[model samples]
Target: MRSAADRETAPAQGAAGWYEAADEPELVEHGAVTGLAVTGQGEPGGAAYNESAGALYAVMGALGAPMVPLEGRWWVEDARSPFEVPREEWRWHLFLRLPDGTATIDAARAEVCSGLPAAARVQHVSYTDGRCVQVLHLGPYSDEPASLARMESLMKAEGLVPHGLHHEVYLSDPREEDPAKMRTILRQPVR
Candidate 1:
């Protein structure tokens, strides 16, 4: 049997199969990934949400960390279809992964000065998702439910239950002119 630590240290490269799922879901092992994090609840583009994301980027740059794609963990107080929830009710933790062994988060927190009030929400956080079910969603964000449904069905088949927040790695910027070309990795931690 593999030790928990052993499992965690394993490179996720061979785990790329988890990053690819078509018409179904696949289980994948993940290692630790660090993030500059901020928490907030509201529509994604709302003032508070945008500011929180802006603050994270500003702080990360100030701390001399290489820029990474934006990632998000989403959840709610009660279980319900995410599609059913009003945009205003959405809660999210927005993050950007920090480079390896860059600097202490405490030092980064202390020196964070983005001139943005949301900078106060910045914190260095690291976690290993362990195991997850994920799929690459190709197209607009609004159509994610169809992909999610396929994932849940596969999870049920594998007798898995979610143990963590719904996660997303934005592979393509939302500002792109063609929403049809947007690519997102939808991930859900499970056991």
Candidate 2:
């Protein structure tokens, strides 16, 4: 919605939406994330989504993850690997949070591809291959059903299965409210 500088210089808006976990590129934190393989079947909706734009930084701090701020357009794929847009949607994305210039996507590989063995509490992370639909959702998560529908339609038309389940790149922090105008990106991974 605004320029990179605007996203930064401009004081934290009342609330923000979601984007790719990688939309905000930054160095990795010094820990891990404790999460499971989240999935969202049905319409283009979301779950356990954050709603505070400014709180994102604090959330990252608590989660021990890293991220950068970005602004762009994106789409939503399906359980299969397909696209809602023709070319790669010019949406916002943050590089995976890694150990200072290391890498963040390894989580997806280890967690999704290999499947974490399960150990102690840490920053439960995940990774996805290049190319993912980044859907910029405006409104409450309940409205996400329609969005998911849109993504499913795109997948069916393109013959792409959203086999990777669902992942929400939380761009806002719920503690702050303003849900009605909140922003979030429901990322449906494609094969």
| Best model number under TM-score | 1
lDDT of each: 0.76, 0.37
Candidate 2 lDDT over 36-144, as tens digits, reads 2222122221221111122223334434555544221233453433344423321222222333333433333344222222211123244433333435666666576
On a 0 to 100 scale, what is the lDDT of residue 70 in model 2? 21
RMSD of each: 5.1, 13.2
**What does candidate 1's lDDT look like per residue over 1-191, in tens digits?**
33333343224633234234443456676778777999999987788888888888888877877777788899877677767888889999998887667566666665665356678778878867777878888888888989899888767766678989899888788556687788888988888
**Model 2 shows how many backbone clashes?**
47
- Candidate 1 local accuracy as lDDT? 0.76
What are the runs in model 2 whose C-alpha is more than 4 Å off?
Answer: 1-96, 99-120, 124-126
Would you estimate the TM-scores of all the predictions? 0.84, 0.42
